[model samples]
Each structure stands twice: as structure tokens, then as C-alpha cells.
Target chain A: MHSISPADFAAILLSLKVGVTATILSLPFGFAAAYLLTFKEFRGRVVLDGVVNLPLVLPPVVVGYLLLLLLGQNGWLGALLNAVGVRIVFTWRAAVLASAVVGFPLLVRSIRIGMEGIDDKLIQASRTLGAHWYDTLVTIILPLSFKGIVAGSSLMFARSLGEFGATIIVAGNIPGVTRTIPLAIYDYAGAPGEEAMALFLCLVSVVISLAVLVLHESLAMRLARRREP
Target chain B: MKLAVEVVKSFGVFRLAAAFSSAGDRLGIFGESGSGKSTLVNLLAGTMPPDEGAIFLDDECLFSREKGINVPPEKRRIAIVFQHPHLFPHLSVRGNLLYGYKRCAPENRRIDLESVAGILKLEGLLERGVNNLSGGEKQRVAIGRAILSNPRLLLMDEPLSALDDELKFQIIPYLKGVCEEFGIPFIFISHSMTEMRLMAERVIVFEKGRIVQQATADQLARLRMPTSQVGYINLLKLGPPRQVDGLYAYSWGGGELLLSFPVRRPDSLIELSSKDIILFKRHPEAISSRNLLRCRVVATFEAGNRTGVEMDCGGERLIAEVARQAAVELEICAGGELFAAIKASAFRELG
Candidate 1:
């Protein structure tokens, strides 16, 4: 029955944008990493897996600091990109990048499990049937693991929507620009007479997380049915 | 078309050294468990590289150690179906059938979806999701998928080994028709002699990572080898001339015989009932049957419901199966001379 303030609405839209952008940007890399980890046997596989999982174990601020070091103007990659007139720090895009980095571990882990659950014989059969490696991956492996991909993406989106620490450190919570729902909630909770708005945002976050969980469960059930003889 | 493969591989303690060549013919690999039959299939499929060897398809070198040429599976155009049907779980039966079909060379596509479906009896299953298929249905779809790819060779690694006998029987006629229609060289791996008899034109017996023998189906059936810690039975093959002077000599064993009715061409392989043969302590006269051999029992062993009596008759070794009760009633024992009376028609030739 209560109307949302302009600021609160902008924060919700910003959160959606950041979450969707983060999920889309991270998907290809997540799939590649997961596929490599699941199918390839290499000398540095353990190291690669550990590195991809680092964001999960490290403090959010530490991930943000690492991102800053890599994307900062004077940093190696940052300088190269700056010379091309590209900027990532302290921007909405930077928020998306931060969210992606923090959410990548979950996506890659889920996708890896999905890819590993596939029958290797299926892939071999495809190959013998004249499909090249890439064709087999695209047509056989990816489609067969669709539920896993959906589940991973949904979890990543939900996680990115709630991202606070890494986003604050990297994009700096600028109002009407980089500030997301979680950041807005933090700001409103700090100000007097903003309790109602903060509660509303919190409730929205809960709803989104619940929706994702339900979607994941349904997808898993469908997959289970598909696997039944 | 011909396939020549010679490969040697070692996996920790398991070693595999397989070598064989076939000229557009079906070759069956026979062995017990752990004999590396599947390993040979994998190597030929190009799924795994052999430590040393060469593989040639006709004149093309698929894999050659001396030349360092190893064509990947995709380029080899050889399709393999594993013991477990590996249909794509996410695809419908039709989609699975087309998955490989689309990737093959357009000009090389010799088999169409309709023909493949007809061959495997997959037309009714085209719209169904692969996940809901029964084991036999899955295998049929898998075979259909492979055939649609227009592969030069088809590798079946115990494709029926996972199914029950009834299901196997149900699908065998379809498989036979496919082979006859296409004349595609097949390398079928199986431990079941019955399956080998049905599917393979030639048999290659494997023992301990090596091919012990390679012969035609008839020769393999007649081969007498030491059975593995178990009893060995030599199969007697009976050709045409079902009636020779009103006496059809079906099988001569242990100087004994049983009468069998004449069967038309291509009868199902029958397991001759050992109990059917009647053993007489003395040669019986006035019998209409013509086959009667005198022999002495060399060994007598009781097996489950029947006693296995090994007898030697005029340079021929025979095994007669007699019920325990009959053995007791007749007092049949080792070193006892007995007249084995078998009707000319009782011999069932097994290939």
C-alpha cells in the first residue's frame, strides 16, 4: 500500500541491471572454465581450479582490492585499457565486474558438477558419429547439461543481486549511478526515517532469492525425470 | 574396405595388445571379463591412443606409429556403440539420431533417417525423449544414430551384453537385417557364444590381452580348447543331408545317441538336452536307429541335476548328460563300457 520513493526505485532497477549484466558476462567464461576442469587433464588444473575458487574464500574487500589493482589506471592491464580510452573503476560497469568476480565461483562450481555428471560415453559416441570436438561440446554436452547451466546462472544472478562488500570497494556506492538495492538498503538503514524503504528492499531480496531457489528445484526435478528410464 | 589395427597399451597393471585385420567383414571378439575386448574397440574408435601401433582403414592410415599419424575419432568416420546406450539425455530420439547425421560429409551420407529408423525400429520412438526409453530402446536409438552418420565401420562393444536374454532375442533380427542390408564391416565384442553365433561371421578369441584364435564361426564352434577351470564341450556340426539312409546321424558322442527330428535350414541354435541320450550297458539290437557306438566311460562327474559322463569311442570323445536317478539306476560309473544309441536326427549342429 506504500509508494516507493524515486531513490528506492532507482536502486532496485540498478540492482537488476547489475545482476543481469554480471550473470551474462560471467557465463561464457564460467562454462569454459567448468568444461576445462571437468574434461581436461593438465599439469596446472589444480592450480586453475583453486584460483577460480579464490573469490569464494577470500574477503569481499580483498577481492575488490585485487580488482582495483588489476583495473586501476596505473595497473598493467588498466594502463593498456586506459590508452584505449576505456575506464572500469568507480563506475556502474565496475559494479557489474565486481559482482561477476564474486559470483563466478558459484557458477563455475555448479557448471562443473553438471558437466561432470554427464556420461563421457555420450561424448565419445558423438565423436565417433562424425562430430568434431566443438560440435560435440555445443550439441551434446551443453544441451545435456542445460539444467545445470540454468541452476548455476540463477544462483549467480541471485548472489550478484545481493553483492555489497565487493561492489562498495570497487564501484563506491554512488547514488543513482552505482548504488544497488543492497547498497541503498545500507544507506537507508543509516539515515533516519528510512526504515520502511530498507525493509521493503530486504523483503524484495528475500523474494528474489526464494524465487531462484524454487526455479532451481523445479529444473532439477525435470532433469531427474528426464534421466528416469 | 578393410580395417587393420595393431595396438599395445598399458594401464597400470592391465596390459592390452590387440592386432587384427578384416576385409569388409564382421569380426567378433570373444573373451572372458578383463580380456581387453572393449579396449580394442576404444582404440579402433580413436577414443584412446595406443602406446605403439598402426591403424589403417582401407588405404588410409588412421593411425601409424612410424609416420606419427593419428587421426582423431571425428575424422575417422567410425561409429561405436558401447555396452551402455549413450543417447543424449537432453535430445529427443529424433534429435539424437540427427546429432551425428548433421556433422557428416554431405556427399558421404549413405544412410537416411527414415532408413535408419526403419532398420532399428525407431520410427515409433522418434518423438519420444531419450530419458524415457527402455534399455533395449535406447540401444536401438543409439544404433540408429550411428547408422545415420554414414560411418564406414560400426563398432559394437558388447551392445547386447547389458540386456536380458529376451530383449537380446527381440533385437537380434533387426540387427541382422541391418548388417545384411548395409554390409558394413562390424567389430562386435561379446562374451556370450550365442551372441557371437548370431552376430558375427568370424570369431576372434582373446585370452590375456592376446588373440588366441581367429576363425570362421563354424571353426570357432568346433575348436576344442581347455575350458577355464570348468568342463569343456566340443560342439559337433551337422550339415545338410538331414537323412542319410533313413538314419540322420545328428551327433556321435560317448558311443551313445539320441534320435532328433529333421529341421529345416537355419534353425535356432539348440542346446542338445544331455538327458535325451539313452546309454545302454550292452549293445541293443533290433533298434530302427542307425547310430550306435561302443565306448568306455573315462570320467564321471555329477553336475547339479545331471551326471556328466565323458566317454571315448573309436578316437572320438563325447559327453553324455544323464539325470542323477538314471545314473544311479544304470549304475553308470567310470571305466564302464556302454553302448550309446543316438538316432541319426538327434544331432543338432551348432555354429
Candidate 2:
């Protein structure tokens, strides 16, 4: 850590911050979309599912380009935010937004699969026992689906760590603010004979992903054991 | 408590049209699967709504098309115990019990946790995790949890179906305590005739999405609601302890049944399993059946794999389920005279 350059350290810190913030910001929306898709019987349910998952199948560059068109300085939303002196485009917040959009489908998919696996009888039992929907969600749905939710959050954080295509176009490569690990690696790879630095950043990304996955697995194992008779 | 249901619901080719009002506290609905027993219970629980009809409980409309009144389940003060326990996996047994108990309106909280736990014998299980409980233990906790909620009406959808015979009988007394002791009204749904005879104060027979009849067991039998499917339940008439067959005897119909257990209560109802009754052409000489009565076949009906011979002894009506081959060999028919031999152990006393 002492031998690492200041630019490399900034890239690592910024990546962690952006990845964590993006996952936190998207958690509510991800859970809501997944719950709606899994439980509710409504018109256009298929369309809602498809829209939530669009980011996963769409190209990252297209996602970034579309985000740019919608949030650029001259863009309507951009102008609205600009008039309030709040800039979301080409800033650290923009990095978080880009990561959130790109990682949302994975989060929702995992949570939805978990929620779908729960017994419908349990929900009915809760209702018959005088629990409202919100009470059931808090007492039954959320706790039982925690495994999938945590797994999804970890996956989204890892995805955000490696995000480059969308992050570059929208958040830009500002060193301290938005130049995360992937952007830094991209910069190193582009420079003449900076192969060693780029390889080091790639190794760091792999380690971070492994660490997150390990944490999730251990927590899931503990939960499994706790549920055992 | 009173339940008045006049509901019509259709799904695909299946249709359910039932209208009945039972003032009895312990009511049982008996039917085969696909006979809409579960569907009717779901309707009562407020989980499933009727397509077109009205449901009322003590003048308060639970569901009505014209009134535009459909009360949600939680507010209906009705609770259900399913075949499976359906305990919250996230909560401990105590937590699950308290969940409903705490949520009930304070003024209406007649059923408390301690009393329920005591009745259901859920003492040691309070702190255990719900997922870690045995099947029978889970069911006990489930009953306690539902009872603790202080529901005006309880629906049991084969709650003991998942248990073994030993566990099933063991838990039956607790159910009696719920009705007889606590005075809570409940509707139990099952396909088992024995269970109905044991639990039902008023028996409702359902067939193919409709309630065919609703009456006491004796009335139900006399009504001839397919006696083959539902066995005979007789109210036992106790006499002073007599050393008959070296055991205490109780008079049933024209004959006396010697029992290992002493019959003290005159109100005890006993079920005679039709499958256990044996028909003989003659009085039969060296057999240990102990009780035999001269019977004349009142009616006969085909019951799928077997023939049902309804016999009349004095005023008692007993349906003996006989195999088709046996019925043919024995030359059993309406108005035929035969002796019905009941093993001393065949009598199951229910109080």
C-alpha cells in the first residue's frame, strides 16, 4: 500500500465509494421492482419485467450514450438540475448513477428469484393471523429473502467496480472524483509501456470481487446453519 | 357465533354454490378432494372471494355483491390452521404465538398466550425456533398461535392430516378444549369420516362443490346422506358398570359393547367404523366378537369399489361396508336378515 502511487490509491478509494453508494441508492428501487414482478397480478406485468431488465441486455455504451442524451448540460433534466446549481453530470454522483443503472437488473433478478421461492402459504398464514401486507413484508418476506438480497447487492457492487463503458461517457475520467479503478486501468493501458500498472489494477479488481463474494457466501452459510434444526 | 354463507363461485367447469347457517360451535364439513371442501374454507377465511353471492357472520356482511362490502381477512377476526403448520420461519415459536395475540384489538382479546399454550401443551416449545420443530410440535404451535389471536371464528383445513394416528388423536383433546372450554366456534374441514364424527357438533356433508346436508350425526345418517361415505355415529347410553365379557359394558342399539375404558359420561358419542362391521348369515358359534345384533338390511348402495349395506337394528341405523364379492356370496340385499357382529374394540368413544 505504501509503494502504490497517489493516483492508484485515489482510483481504489473512488471505486469503493462509488460502488457502495450506487448499490445503496438502487436497493429500494431494485427490491420494489422485484417484489412487484413476483407477487402482484396486474396488467402489463411482462412489460414491467422487460423494462427493469433492459439494462442487462442492452450494450453498456448505448446505456451511457442514452444517459448522456438525457442528462447532458443542454438536456432538459440537466438544465433543470443546472438551474438549481446541482450538477449530476460529469461528477462523482454521476458515476454512482451510471453504476446503479448498469447493476440494477442483476439486483432485481436475484431478489425476485428469492421472493418467488417463498411459500405462498406462509404469506396467507400471516394475513390470516391479522398481519397486513406491510407487516408480512417486514416480518416474513424481507428476512427470508435476505440471502438473495445480499447476494444481489454484492454482485451489483462487483459489477460497479468493473464498470467502464457507461462510467466514462457520463461520469468522465476526472482523477479524484470519477476516475475509478477501471478508468484508471484504461488510462494505464493506453499509455506507452504502462502494462505493469494496468495489470496491477486488474488484479485489485479480481481481489475485491472475490472478497465480496466470500463475505456473502459466509453470511449465507451462517443463515443456512441457523435455519437447521 | 354464527356463520351464514350463500356464495356462488365458478372456475373453469367447476362451480361452488353453498348456502348454510350453523349456530353450533363445533361444525365440521366433510368431502372428498375436488369436492370443494378446501375452496369453501378459503371463502370462509376471506382469502378467496365469491363470484356472486353474500356471506354474513352475525348480521355483519363479510361479502356481498349488492352491498359492495368485502372485508379483508385480517379485519374479519377469522383464523385458519392449515394442513402444514405454516409457522413463520424467521420467528421463534414464542414470537409466532405472540404475533397474532398482540395484533388482536385489546378489547376483543379474550384468548391469551398463556392459556392457549397451556391448552395445547406448548410449554417447552416456546423458545424453540419454528424451523427446528418436529412436525407434530409444529402443528401444536400452529394451533396455539391461531387460538392466541382471539378469532371469532377458526377454520381448520385438515390440520391433523399431516400427523400420524398417535399424534392425531393426541392433539384432538386440545381441539375439544378450544371448543368446549374456550367456547370458540370453529369449522373443521376433512375427508375423514371418523374425524368429522369426533369433532362435529353439526355435520355438513359436501359433494361436488355443494353442501348436500347439514345436521347432527344421527340426523345426517337418518337423512341418508350417502351413509356409505360417512359412517354411523351413535350417542352412547351408559348403564351401571356390569361385568359383561369381563369388561364394563355400554348399551348401543339393541346390543351391549364391552369396553376396556369405562364409560362415565352419558353424553359421550361413539363412532362405529363401517369398515369394521362384519355381516354373518348365521348367529355364528365360536367367535370372540362379544356383541351381535339381529339386523335387517334397510337399503343398499354401490360405493365405487364396494357395496354399502345399510342395516336397521331396532331404531339404530348402521351402514356396513362390505366388499362386492362378499356381498354377492352372502346374498345380502334390502330386507335381508343378518347378524351384525361388532368387535368389543371397534367402538371409539368421543366426548
Candidate 3:
């Protein structure tokens, strides 16, 4: 194999950085959404649930375009942010936002399953035992559904690593600032006489995804065993 | 605990409208499944709010639709022991017990973990995980956890209904003893008449979302004797027995009674069905039955097809059921003398 170029190395590092940053940023909001969807009763709950799950079913390109419109330079939110001198479009932050929005439903769905599996009686027992709602949420709900959180985070991170359509439209294909592994691969595939480099990056993607899935499976098994024994 | 509840709650087709007050230290909510007993418990514990009306615990308003006063379960200080143990799987036995104790307010914290563990006989299992404990031990830990909260009232919602007969009786002592020792009043809920008799002094019976009866457990038992499949079980507490000619003889109120079941425990409870006792006009010359007592009838009540004769033999009370025709032929009356015979195999040890 040909020695890897510096630009490719930067792409690889940025892919991992964006994946990690997106997953971390989405954790609290994901948990909150899952908690509300699973436990709370309110008006328009079904509507809120439908909205949360929209990005999962929508095409990635359409999601990217919708996000572009929402955070464009002349958009309301973008203009408000510009008043405070902060830029989000065509930057690494835009890549993070795009990845987060696309992967959010998966995160929320996984955590919601975990939260739903918890017996209602356990929550009632905690309350009658003198735990306030927030106290019970922190002590009981959070710990009991931690496996779901971990699984969701891992799945979302893997999804973010492969983000393409959204990242290209929102973050653009900058060499070091915004281009990730997939974008780099797309660039190499288009250029003549760069098949080997593309194939090598493809191999790297396969390795990273496999490692994450295997780690996720092993962590889940370990959690199940610890809970039982 | 003095609880006054007048609440109405509905879930689709089933509606619960309960209104009652209880001041007893040990109160039993007796009802069959789907009788709204659990709904009443939820309302009392503040885990579920009532659609209308109010609830007062010792005259302190816990919930009131008119006043817009609805105290949450935590602030109500009313703990519950659910049918299943429901212990936190991540926590050890000690952690589960202290989960409530740590949350209790300082001034309201009267029972500590040590005392709860000691009372529930959970000292050795404290460090062990809750998943590994036996069913009875898990229930003991649950009761201990509830007690450690130092709640003003503990609602035990069929805590032992999930256990087998032997385990049910074994945990009854811990359930009763823990509450008594801590001076925490509790409402015991169960469908088992035996459990109600053993645990609660006064019972509020529920039938189809309504309070049908509120009376002593014994009175309720007698009232249902004609209809119950097991007619009026007479619970007898006897001391350790001595072996006599292949029979176990335990002292009664002031006399001796022979039973076939051997009881190793120092104090044991035995049940004898009312139908097991036979009445005779005079002492027979020879009989297969072992116990023959000279007794005077204290009272006579009409059971379904037979008459229940309340008799006093050697200062102890025993009810002997006889056919109405035989009662009339034998001239069975409140002040008449009669002879009662019971076989040695008739007694069954309960706990």
C-alpha cells in the first residue's frame, strides 16, 4: 500500500473527533427526549414523538438541505447567532450538528426501549420510599437504563463516523477543517489513479466500524451478566 | 396512624369510590383481585391522585381537590411494600435498605438501617446482592427498606401473596414484628383470610370497588363461614408437645389435647375445621376418636345446612358443627351440657 498522505490522516482524525463530539453533545438531550417519550404524559406527546423520529426516516440529503435552510447565513437562527459573532455553517461545528441531528432518533429510540423495560412498580416503590421525582430519575431510572444509553451512544457514534450527505452539504468538503473519512474517500474515488488510497481508507472504515460493534456487543453482555450475578 | 380517605377515581370502565376511616395500628384491606383494593392503596400512598375529594392522615391534609392540596408520595411519608420485592438490582441488600433511610428527613428519621436489619434478621445478607437472596429474604429486605424510611404509615400490598404457604407464614412474623417494634402503623392488604386473621386486628373488606364491611378479622371470618369453602377454621396456639403413645399431646387452655401432627417449634399455630368435631348426648363406652371432652354450649348459630355450637370445654372454646336435625334431637341449646369428640388426625399445623 502507498504511504498515507497528511490530508488523509487529517480526515481520519477529524472523523473520529466529529463522531465523539456529536455523540457527547447529543447524550443529555437524547436522554431527556427518551425520558419524556417513555414516562411522561402530556398533550401532543404523539406529535413530539413523531417529530423526534422524523430524521431517521427522511433521506439524508433532505435532512442536510433542511438543516442548511435552518442554519443558513440568512436564516433566523443563523442571523441571531451572527449577531453574537458565531458562525456554524461551512465549519466543523456544522459537521457535528449535521451528524447529531441525523443520529438523534437512533439514540433516543434505544434509550427509550431501555427506559420502557424498567418495571413501573420499581419507580413507584422508589417514590413511596421517599424519593422525589428528580431523585428517583437520578438514582433509579438513570442507572437502570444505563445499558441503553451506552448502546445508543455507540450506535450513534458509528453512524456519525459514516455521515456523508449531511456533512458535505452543511460542513462542505474542506480538506482539514470539515472533510471526514467518507468525504476523503469520495474525493479519492473521483481523482484518477487514486484507487489504492480509496480502498485503504475503505479498509480503515471497515476496521473502525467492526471494532465499535464488537465493543458494543461485549459491553452489553458484560452489563447483562453483572445485572444477573 | 389515623387515616381518613374519601376519594373517587375512575379508569375507563372500572370506577373506585371508597370512603372510610381507620385508626387501628394494624389495618387489613381484604378483597379479591380487581376489587379496587390496590387503587385504595395507591390513593392513600399518594402514588395516584384521586379525581375528587380529600385524604387526611392524622388530620393533616395529604390530598384535597377542593383545597388544591396534593402532597406527593415522597412528602407524604407513606412507604409501601409491593407484592414483588422490587429491590434495585444494582444495589446490594444494605444499599437497598438504606435507599429509603438516606432519603428520609433527619427529624423524621426514627428507624435506622442497623435496627431494621437486626429486626428483619438481615444482618448476614447485608453485603450480598439482592438478586441472590431467597424469596422470603427478599421480602424481608423489602419490609426492612420500607420500615427504614420511618414513614408514618406503611402500606403492605399483598407482600406475601407471591410466596408459597410455608414462606408466607415465615415472613408474617417479620412483617408483624417489624412494624410493632418500630411503632410504625401499617395497612396489610391480602385476599387470604388466614393472613388477615394473623396480621390485622381490624379489616376493611372491598368488593367490586366498594367497602362492603369494616369489622374485626375474626368477625369477618365467622360471617363468611357458611359461604367459605373451608368452614370457619379455628386457630389454636399450642405450646411444645410431649409424645404419648405415638401421639403428640399439647396443652390447651387448661387441659390436654392429642394431635397427630408433631410440632417442633416452641409455639405453633394449629387449625381445626368446625366440621371435624362431633357432638354426643352422653359419653360413649368405646370410640375410635381420641379426644372426648365434657362441655357446655355457650352459643348456637345457624350455618348453611348445619348448626355451629360454640362450646366451652375445660375453659377453652371450640366450635362443633352439627346437623339441625341432630341439634333438635339432642336438644342442643346455649346452656346445655354435651360431649364432644375429635380424632387425633384432625389438627393441621399452620406455622
Candidate 4:
């Protein structure tokens, strides 16, 4: 029988918390960006869309470096926060921010595709039915794009769980405080005679990724059925 | 409830320019596809902004380029039902219906959920998911949802065009009842003359993006068909006449007209064409005709003097065609009574 260490178990729980927080923080902004990109036409729209997707093409380390410059204690935004006595650097919240930055592109892209696939006439009909923009979004757009939201959140959570480069650079690996599962696995793998613990963490990551994938596929299938005329 | 609109907009290569108005009435916008009917509805509903012009619903100006006023769709107080019902897939029938009502201001609320459901015959569907509804059922739910919003105006852009004839017929009465009960002004778009006759009291003909004609229902119907086709046929007031049997009899001009041909279904209204009619000046002495009526022409018209005359015999009217020379010789004119004859086979059943 394999025994799991308390520190390793704490890392798992912390990883879940980070993944969930990142997903929740990014979802509303992701939906808004996706909807604007898919439905509205304005000057510089293409530029805005490209910017939202920058995190996907740029290296995770680069994203973390950018975050550090903007959010570190002596950084521009960090200076303003320090004046107000609020700190975000080298904390669990910083890990969530890094995860969200890396996962945003994926979340927005999926939701945009889902928004584009919806029938425009349906939105028009809702407008004619006396619903305003916010009402229409809540009642029509959100409900219809629910599958995309679920899929995007799942993908983001899975990606955040495995986040290593950005999290390491921004939050700095600290056991029991900031060290998530992926970071702990990296730390264990670096030490001599800790190969078994590293392997166990890797196996756990694979299982989580697989489960999320299965759940996403099932949700997507159900949404497809509902869309059928 | 007057609705006046003038809008000009361009989308890529498609340019739309339209202007028209209607009082408190059921006005139909009739045109072929790509004639900008849907675009007109969109403009009216405030979904698309017009490059120029204004729309006034009664005294409230919904949109105006001159005044630089553009009300958003939610504040327009208008309801629209598209050809596709567009019910929210995640919502049940009840949820879909209640969505608009919840969004409306309390002071502006006029329709209740129960009343809308009852009017649209949607009581049995409240608990069902919108995704599970049939084509007709979805339309009913869509209508109910729109009504519950307490809209001042209702726009229907070919709402029944997607359904089959049977379904269209099934749901049309409910729609008509909704309009009548609420006294809400309706701008209904349709291509079918039959549907126009069934619902609209006024008609606005569209050619391209321009309004060609706007007339009352009876005037539109008269202008649509030739003068020869405008007349009353012998209407049989049936009281549970034979079930499934097509044969029936009705009296007109003190004569019996036997309907020997099986009507297939007699529960619905039927229309007949004027071209199928054959007229005679005298009662046929010898013929296999199953239907014949003796009557006098109350009115007549000269169809280039070639077609003899259109005769109104008692309450039934029939058209007879004769040579131009024969019309001068017979001396047929208005108020001249004449014998009109028809063969039973000429009456084709239109359901």
C-alpha cells in the first residue's frame, strides 16, 4: 500500500483552491471578451481580440515575467497597492493570478467560438420580445453558451493545476503556503531519493486531467443534442 | 396606436430604404424574399440602428436621426416573434415565458403569466423544456413569452413561414385571438395571400425596399384579384353535416346546388377560383350539371366587351365571357338580371 505524506496532501488541496479561484476570477471577463469579439464590430476590434489571445502564444515564463513587472512590490501597480497597504506578491493570490493569465486565452477562445455559433435571429427575437441587452445575455446568451462555459472552465482548471513556469516565477514555491501540486512535484523530482513521491504526483495530475476531459466530452455531447432542431 | 417608420441602412452591399406607417390595426407587410421585410422588423425593434430616419410608435419616438435619439431594444416596448421561435433552450416553457416579465418594470406590467399561457394554449407545456417542444408548440411559447412582456407593439417576421400548413392553421387562430384580446398593434410579415386574409385587416405591399401600396383588407383583396373574382359564393351553413362524407347540398337563388364530389374534409374553410366557373344565360334544358341556380344580374361590368359580363345573381355572383360583338347584341349592362349556370365539376375544393 502506498502512503501519501501530509505535505503532499496539503499541496493537492491548495492546488484545487488555486485552480478554482483562477477559473472563477477569469470566467466573467472571459465571457464578456468573447461576446464582444464574436458579436460586436468596432475599430481596433481585431487588435483587441489578438491581445486577449497573447497569453496563448507567449511562453508561460514570459507571462509570469510580465506579471512580476506589473504586480511585484516595487512594480507599477504594486507601488499603488503598497501605498494602500495591500500586498499580492509571493502569495497564494499571486499563484491564482498567474494561473488565470495563462488560462484566459483558452477560456475566451472556446467561449467566443460558442457565441459565434448561436443563431443571430434568436437574439433579435429576444430583443423584439422586449428584453434588454443584460436580460438577453442572462436569459439567452448565457444559457445557450452554458456548454462552452463548462468546457472552458474545465480546461482552465486542468491547465491551472499543471501550471509551473508562471506560478514559480510569480508566487515563488513555498511549501504548505504557495507550493501547489505541480510545484511540489517539481521540488520532489529535484531531490535525491524522492522519485516515488514525484511519480505519485505526476500520476495524480494525469488522473485529474483525464477525468476533466471525460466530463467535458459528456457535457459537450449533451449540449449538442439540445441544439438539434 | 399609430406606427410610423422611415429608415435607411446599409450592410456591405445590401442597402435598405423603407418608410411606412399604420394605425391601431393588423397591417401585413407582403413581399418576396430579400425584399428587406426582416430588416424592417429589425429596425422597428431597435435591434439595428438606421443610418438615418425615425420611428414613432404612437406619440413615443422610438428612434430619430434628426433628434439623435435611439432607444435600445429593451426599452422599445415592442415584442417580436421570428419565423424560428427562438425559445431559450436552457429554460422550460414557463421560464421562457417569465423571463421577459421579470425584466419589465413593475409599473409597466400589463400581462400576467397565467393569462398569456391561457391565451396561447400553453398550460400543458409550462413544465416542459423548450428544447423538447415541437415546431407549433415552440411558436406558442415564444408568443406567450413576448406577450408577458407587456409590449406596446408586436412585430412578427414571418412567424408561421417555417411551419407546415397544418401547424400554421392550428396556431394562427391563437395568434389572431392574442391580437384581438390585447388590442396590441401588430406588424405581421407574410408572403402567402391566404395567411394575409386570415390575419391582417390591412396590407402594405413591399417592392424592394419601398412601400408600393397600403390598403384596407377588403380593398387589398379586391385589388389583388380581378373584379370578376370578387363575389359571394353560396355559403352553406352546415350543422354537423355528414362526417367524412364530401357530398352536401346548399341553396342559392331559390335553387339547390348539389356538391356531388367528395370534399374530403369539410371542417375547415375552403376557397374556390373564379376561372373554374362556367356561366350560362339560361337554365340548361338538357345537361349533366348537378348544380344550377336561377337568378338575375344585380350588376355587370364590361371586360373590354369581350367577356360578356360579371353578374350578381341574388347573393351569388358569377362571371360570363362572350364575344365583344355578342355583348353589344345582348345589351347586357348594370342592373340587368340574367340566368347564371355552373357545372358541379367546376367547383374545386380548396382547403
Worst 10 residues of 1 chain B by lDDT: B224-233
What's the i-RMS for candidate 3 in angstroms?
1.2
Mind giving the per-residue lDDT tens digits that candidate 4 earns over A1-229? 2368788888988898999999999999999999889888899998988889999999999999999999988799999998998777789998999999999999998887778778997787677666767877887888778878998899899989989899999999988888999999898888888889999999988887898889889988887776653
lDDT of 4 at B187: 82
Tens-place lDDT digits, model 1, residues A71-177: 89887978898999999888898899999999999999989888988888988988898888898899888977777788889989998998988899889888888
Cα lDDT listed for each candidate: 0.80, 0.84, 0.91, 0.78
Q: What's chain A's TM-score in each predicted model?
A: 0.92, 0.96, 0.96, 0.93
The candidate scoring highest on TM-score is 3
- In candidate 3, position B204 carries an lDDT of 94
Q: Name the DockQ score for candidate 4.
A: 0.49
For candidate 3, give the docking quality class from DockQ: medium
lDDT tens digits, residue span B272-297, model 1? 43444568877786676556778789
The candidates, ranked best first by lDDT, are 3, 2, 1, 4
Native-referenced Cα lDDT, model 2: 0.84
List the candidates ranked by TM-score, beginning with the highest: 3, 4, 2, 1
The complex in candidate 2 yields a DockQ of 0.57
Q: What is the lDDT of residue A129 in candidate 2?
A: 86
Model 4 global lDDT (CA atoms, 0 to 1): 0.78
Report the lDDT of model 1 for residue B136.
87
Reference-based lDDT, residue B54, model 3: 98
Error of 4 at B257 (Å): 4.6
Interface Cα root-mean-square deviation for all models:
2.4, 1.5, 1.2, 3.1
